[model samples]
Target: MLHAVIMAGGTGTRFWPASRAASPKQLLPLVGKSTMIRQTYERLEGLVPPEQTLIVTNQQLVEPIAEQIPELPVSQLVGEPCKRDTAPCIGLAALLVSRKDPDATMLVMPADHVIRSRNHFQSAVKQAVEMVGKSQAEIVTFGIKPTYPAEIFGYIHRGAAIDTRGDSAPSYVVKHFREKPNASTAAEYVSSGDYFWNSGIFIWKAKTILDALAAQQPEMLEHLKKIVDAWGTDKQDEVLEKEFTAIEGISIDYAVMEHAKNVAVIVAPYDWDDLGSWLSLARLLGTDRDENTIVGKHLGMNTKGTIIRSTDDHLVVTLGLKDCLVVHTPDATLVANKNDEESIRNIVKLLEQRGMTEYL
Candidate 1:
């Protein structure tokens, strides 16, 4: 059986005001009519069924996510007791899938990305799954061709092509994984065609990943085993709360993918966007004649190269603002230079320190 695990635990502080603690970016309809997570589920229509699709999110978001994804079984929605980053998140899901069927193939993906081409995305995922079925590769991850020297995203270096059993899409062994680099280093990576943006999407057998975790991350694996043993029993939630807290918060990339030698990369054949920040949204929704990305009703006298978004019906009027980001919500409003988009997280921290919990 093939299962899909959608990682939806991110707080998305960069998209603050619009994205809050209770309701994150994955549940917001930032791009199209449907919420980001709903769009993600729809993309897997022909690939995986709703029953096999698992959503791993925060405990607070369980009910809201269930309401948004009514088709998904409430039992399949695994809620984390606390934030444990991607390593523990994927490990927990892997254990559950392994419990169902040890040989099950799991497709791990984030719920917040905006993928434009659904057909191509499905084809690529199917290709990766089929490739994994026939090959000895333990894990397969997707890599997007770099469009620019993005300093924020990690890069995957492509190694030599691996010999597959049949005529399949080109797959390369992963040479190395590079963390977010400085501008000069990022430019070097982009200049070399071997580097691809690490999409953070992965596919592997439930048991295979478990084996790797046992070798590379023994402590986390032990915790996962305890949780898996408790499944279907009354002690499941009790074990999860205790063991998950003990598991260290780390990314799967650093814990397994970067260290594992059996990893491979499938060059993604679709348009992908993480939708990480307001700058990304601005780029997706191109600027108007004044070079401003405006979502709601706004009247600007001399605003140029700015991004303005409002949820309320109130008309926003700007005066002589240029290259700015103005986001208006019911409780909070953010007005800053577009260059300061990366510092949105800092602003969120400031709000937290100032005891403005209502805005967050």
Candidate 2:
């Protein structure tokens, strides 16, 4: 059986005023009319149905997520009691899904990424499912074709191509993974043409990934074992809450995938964006003739290459400003250089210190 688990637990503090603790980026219509979470579910229509799809998010978000995605069965919404990071999120979802079907090949994807080409994305996922079904490998992550020398994203080096015909498409054994690089390194990687932007989307069978975790991260795996072992018993949820606390807060990339030798990379050709920070938001938005990405009602004067977004009806005017980001909400209005967009996370931290929870 094939199933998909969308990890929607991120806080998305970088997109502050717009994305708050109560409603994060996944629930907001950042890109278009629908929320990113809804887009993720819609993207998987033919690949996996709502019955086979699961959404893993924080316990606080369960009710709101359910409200946004009412089509999902209540049981399919897996909630984490605490923020245990990606390792536990993945492990918990895998454990729950495996309980229903042992042979489940799970497509573990993030809920916030914007993948434009639906047909291409679906084709790649279907191919990866067929490939993983036959292999004993533990994990498979999609690596987006690097369109530019982006220093923000990690890179995946492709190894020998699998023996598929020309129509076989771009699938490769991951040679090595690289952390975010400097400008020179990023340019070198882009010039080589083998490096891919790590999309953080994964695929693997439940048993295969569990075995790899057991091998590479025994401590995390042992803690997860206690939860899985209690499945179907009356003590499952209680045991899960307790035992999950004992696990370390680490990403699957650091705890397992980076160390596991069987990891594979499926080269995804579709346009993909993690939307990690405000800079990413500004970069990926649509622009008008004045070269401004205007979200709400706005009248600009000589504003070029700037993003001005406001939920309110307030009119925004920019005078002789280029490459700027202006975001206006009821609580706060932010004006910053577009080049320094990633620093918004630091601004969020400062707000937290000042006890500005109302604006956040």
Clashes of each: 0, 0
RMSD of 1: 1.6
Candidate 1, residue 303: lDDT: 86
Error of 2 at 239 (Å): 3.0
lDDT of 2 at 181: 98
Model 1 segments beyond 4 Å from truth?
Answer: 162-169
lDDT of each: 0.88, 0.84
TM-score of each: 0.96, 0.94
User: Against the hidden true structure, what lDDT does model 1 obtain?
Assistant: 0.88
